[model samples]
Target: MPIYQAPVRDTLFVLNEVLGYERYTNLPGFSDASGDVLEAILAEGARLAENVILPTNRVGDMEGCVRHDDGSVTTPKGFKEAYRQYCEGGWMGLAAPVEHGGQGLPYAVHTAVAEYMVSANLALLMYPGLTQGAIAAILTHGTDEQKTAFVPKMVEGVWTGTMNLTEPHCGTDLGLLRTKAVPNGDGTYKISGQKIFISAGEHDMADNIVHLVLARIEGAPEGVKGISLFIVPKLKLDAAGNPGERNTLSCGSIEEKMGIHGNSTCVMNYDEAEGALLGEPNGGLRAMFTMMNEARLGVGLQGLSQSEVAYQNAVAYAKDRLQGRSLTGVKAPEKKADPIIVHPDIRRSLMTMRAFNEAGRAFTLWTALKSDVAHRSGDDSDRQAADDHMSLMTPIVKGVLTDKGFEHAVMAQQVFGGHGYIEEHGMSQFVRDARIAMIYEGANGIQALDLVGRKLGANGGRAVQAFFKEVGEFCEENRADEKMAPYTKALKKGLNDLQAATMWLMQNGMKNPDNAGAASTDFLHLFGLVALGYMWAQMAKTAQGKLADGANGSTSFYDNKLVTGRYFMERVMPETAAHLARLSSGAETMMALPAEAF
Candidate 1:
C-alpha cells in the first residue's frame, strides 16, 4: 500500500509564517479561522486523509467503479463509507456560504483541506470536488428558489453535482456543441443530448446528481452565444422538494480509461430529460465559466498532489534500494552497495521534485488567498484587483503545474528503475493519473491560449502590470538584505526574462497572429516559472527570518527550507530564460513546415 502523510506542518508554515494568514481575519468568514482553529481543522483533515482515504486508493484503483445493468454505479469497497465519514465531518461545505449550511470559512482553508483529500485519493475526491464547483455555479447564477431547493442539499452532501459540457463531436469548441433544449410551455425545458467523459457522472454515492448542462434553446442564435444552461436532475423532485420521480437519463456506458478507474467517467444519454433553465436564456457559457474556472484550479492542485505523493514514495525507495557504490566513496562499505539516494543523479531528481512541490504549494495557496479576497473583501476595487489577478494566474497555475507535475511524476518513477514500472508498487498509477490533469479542464494548450490571447489584454493589462509591480517591489525591498540577496537577485533575473518575453509577444504577435499561437505555451510556462520563483523568494525570506530568530528549536526544518529555496532559485529559475528564447523565436520556424512535408 502507498503511504500519504498530509504535510500538515508544511501547510501550517505557509499559512502562519509565509503568508501571515491571520492578518486577513478582518475579512468576512476569516475571523473564525485563527491559528489554533486552522491547526485543529487541518489536523482532523490530515487524520481522515491518512487513515481512511489512503487505505482505499489501491483498492479503488484495482476494483474500479462498477456500473450495473440497471445503470446504477457502485464504487469500490469502503468508498461509500469513507464518503459518509467525509460528509459527516461537514467537509463538503468547508468553504461554502453559511446561509447554505456551510462552515463559511475562507477559500484558503478549503484549498488546504482539499489538497489533503486529493493527495490521499484523487478518484474519491472527484465526487465531492465536482459537487463543490457546481455549487459555486448555482450560487453565482441560480435563482432564489433554485438556491433554496438545491444548494443546501449539495452543501450538506445529500446530493452531488456535475458539469456536463463535452459531447461526441466537441471538446474545446463550445460553438460546435449539438445538444438541444426545447422549452416546454410551462417553464421547464426538454433536454436531449449525449455527454461524454463526464467524471463522477453516474455514481450511486449520493441521493441526487444535479447536472448543470449546456444546451442550445430552440430558435436561439447560432454558435456559443446561443448556448443555455440547465439544471437536469437524475431524479425528479417531489412537491415537498424530495427526490420523487426518475428522470429520463441513463449512463450509456462507463469509459474504460487509462487511469482514474476509481472514478466513474460516463457516457450519459439524455432523451428529453426534464430540465429547468439556469441563469438566463442564451447565457449558459457565462455561467458555466464559473464551474470551469473552479475545476481548472482544482485540476492544477491534482497535478501537484500527484507529484507530492509520487515524490514521497520515490524518496523512500531511493533510500532503501541498493544499487551501486557511490562515485565519491563507499559510504555504505558494510553493505555490498550504497543506497540509490547517495548517488548524485538521484539527488537531482529528488531535488527537482522537492523544489517544484514546495514552490507550487505556496503558489496555489497564494492564488486561493486571492480568491478569498475577490469573494469576501469589502472594498470593491480590492475585489476587482484580486479577481483580475486570479484570472491572470489561473492558466499558469493549471498549465505549468500540471505540465511539471507529470514530468516530476515520470522522474520519480524513473528513480525506482524497474520496480516503478510494475503496478504492484503503485508508482505507475501516479504517472497515469498525473497524465490526465494536463489534458482536461480546458487542456493545457487552451489554457496557454487563454493566457496569451485573452488574459494579457483584459482590463488593459491591469493584472499583468500589477503582478510585475508586486514582484518588482518584493525584489527591491529585499535587495539589500545579505541573507536574502541571492533569492532576490535570481527572482529579478527571472522577472526580467518574463518581461522580455511579454514585450516580444506584444511586438511580434500583432503582426502575425500565429506568432502568439506558437509562443503562447512557452510564454505561459515562462510566466509560471517566474511566478513560482517569486513564491520561493517569499518562502526564503520567511525561512531567513526564522533562522535569524534562532530557528525556534527547529533548526533542521528551517535550514532545509532555506537550502531548497536556494536550489530552486539557482537551478529552476534559470529555465525561464530558455523559455523566453523559444517564445521570442516566434512562428518563423514553427510555421515554416508545409502540411505535406510531414
Candidate 2:
C-alpha cells in the first residue's frame, strides 16, 4: 500500500521561521495561535491525516460514491464516520469567526493543517473543503439573518455547502447561463434550473446541504448583469430554524468522472426551489466570486498535496527496490543490486519533486498570510496592499502550482516504472486525482488569460509593479551576502525575465489582441517561476540564518534545505528564460494557421 507522512517539521519551518507567522499577533486571530498552540494543532492534524484519513484513500477510490433510486448518494465506507470525527475535532471552524462558533485562529494555521489533510485524502476532505468556501461567501456577503440561519450549522459540519454555477451548456461563460429565478410573491424567489458537475451536491454525510446558486432574475437584464445569487437549501428550514421540509431539488445523477470519485459530482435538477437572494439583484457574479476565489486557492493546494504524497511513496519505493549496480562502486554488496536511489537519474527525479514541494509550501503559506492581513488588518492602506497581493498571486498559484504539480506526479510515477502504472501501487490514482486540479477552478489556460488580460493591467499595474519591487528589493538587499548569492542571483534573473515579458505584453499585445491570447499561458508561467524563485530565496536566507545561529541541533535539516533550494535555483529557475523567449516571439506563427486546415 502507498504511504503518506505529513511534513510537520518542514511546515513549521516555513511558518514560524521563514514566514514570521508570529509577527502578526496584532491581527484578530493571530494572538491565539501561539507557537505551542500551532505545533499542537499541526501534530493533531498530522495524526488524523496519517492514521484516519490516509487509510481511506484507496478504498474511497476503489469503492467510489453510490447514487440510489431516491437520489440519495452514499459515500465510500468509513467516509461518514471520518467526516463525523473531522467535525467533532472542531477543524471545520478553525479559522472561522468566533461569533460563528469557530476557534477564530489565524487562517495561516488553518491552511497548514489543511495541507496535511488534503495530502492524506483529497477526495474525502473535499466534502468540507467546499463547505469552507461556502462559509466564506456567506460570511462575507450574507445578511445577518442569513448568517444566523446558516453559518453556524455549516461551520459545525452538521451541514455542508456547495457552489452551483455550471449548467449543461455553460461552464465558463456566465452570460450564457439559462438558469432562471422568479419572485415567489413573498421575500423568496423560485429558482428553477439544472446545474451539472456540482461537487458535494448530494451526500448522506451531512444532515443538510446549503447550495449557493447563480441564476438570472426575471427581466433583470440581457447578459451577466441579469444574474443573481440565491441561498437554496436541500431541506428548507422550519420556524425553529431546523430542517423541516424537503426542498424542491434532487440529484439527477452522479457524473462518471476520471478521478475524485469519492466526491459525488452530481447533476442537480431544480423544480421551482424556494431560495432567498444572497446579495443585491444583478450582483450575483460579484457575490459568487468570493467563494470562487477561495475555492481557486484551495484547488491550488490540492495540486501540491497530490505531488507531496506521490513523492513520499516514490522515495520509499526507490530506497527499497534493488536494481542495477551503482556506476560509482558496489556500496551494497550484501544485496543482489544497489537500491534504485543510488542511481543518478532516480536521484534527479526525487530531488526535483522535493525542491518543488518545499518551495510550493512556502509559496502557499506566504499567500495565505497575505489573505490574513487583507481580512484582519484595520488600516485601509495595509488592507489594500494585501488584497492587491492576493489579486496578483491567485492565478499564478492556481495555474503554476497545478501545472507543475501534475507533471511531478507523473515523474514520481515514472520512478515506479511498470509498478506505478498498475492499480496495486496507487500511483495511478495520484496521477488521476491530480489531473483534475489543472482543469478545474478556472482551468490553467483561463487562469493564464485572467493574469495577462485582467490582473496585470488592473489599477494601472499596481499589483504587478509592487510584486516586481518587492522581489527586486530582496535581490538588492541580499547581493552582498555570499551564502545568499546563489539563490538571489538565480531569482534575480528569473524576475528580470518576468519583467521583460510584462513589458513585451504591454508594448505589443495592445496592438494585436491575438498576441496577448497566445502569450497568456507562457506569461503566467513565467510569472509563477519568479514567484516560486522568490520563495526559494527567502527560504535560503532563513536557512542560512538558522545555521549561523547553530540551528539548535538541526544541522542536517538546515543543510538539506539549502541543498534543495540550490537545486531549484540551478535546474528550475532557468525555465523562465524559455517562457520569456516564447512569449516575446508573439502569436504570428502560432495563429497563422487556419482552423479549417487541421
Question: For each candidate, what is the lDDT?
Answer: 0.93, 0.93
Worst 10 residues of 1 by lDDT: 26-35
Q: In every candidate, how many clashes are there?
A: 0, 0
lDDT of 1 at 342: 96
Candidate 1, after superposition: displacement of residue 57 in Å? 0.9
Best of the candidates, lDDT: 2
User: Can you tell me which runs of candidate 2 are displaced by over 4 Å?
Assistant: none
Task: For candidate 1, write residues 1-598 as lDDT tens digits.
Answer: 6778898999989988999899898898888888789999999999999999998889888999999999999999999999999999999999999999999999999999998999899999999999999999999999999999999999999899999999999999999898999988989999999999999999878999999999999999999999999999999999999999999999989999888889999999999999999899999999999999999999999999999999999999999999899998998989999999999999999999999999999999999999999999999998999999899999999999999989998999999999899987898888988899999879999999999999998988999999999999999998889899879999999999999998988899989999999999999999999999899999989988888899889889989999999999988889998998898888988989899998
Tell me the tens digit of each residue's lDDT in model 2 across 1-598.
8899999999999999999988999999887887898899999999999998888899999999999999999999999988998999999999999999899998888999999999989999999999999999899889999999999999999999999999999888888999899998899999999999999999999999999999999898988888999999999999999999999999999999999989999999999999999989989999889998999999999989999999999999999999999999986999999999999999999999999999999999999999999999998999999999999999999998899889999999999999999999999999999999998778899999999999999999999999999999999999999999999999999998999999999999999998999999999989988888898899889989999999999999999999999999999999999999998999999988899987
lDDT of 1: 0.93
The parts of candidate 1 lying over 4 Å away from their true place are: none
Error of 1 at 274 (Å): 0.6
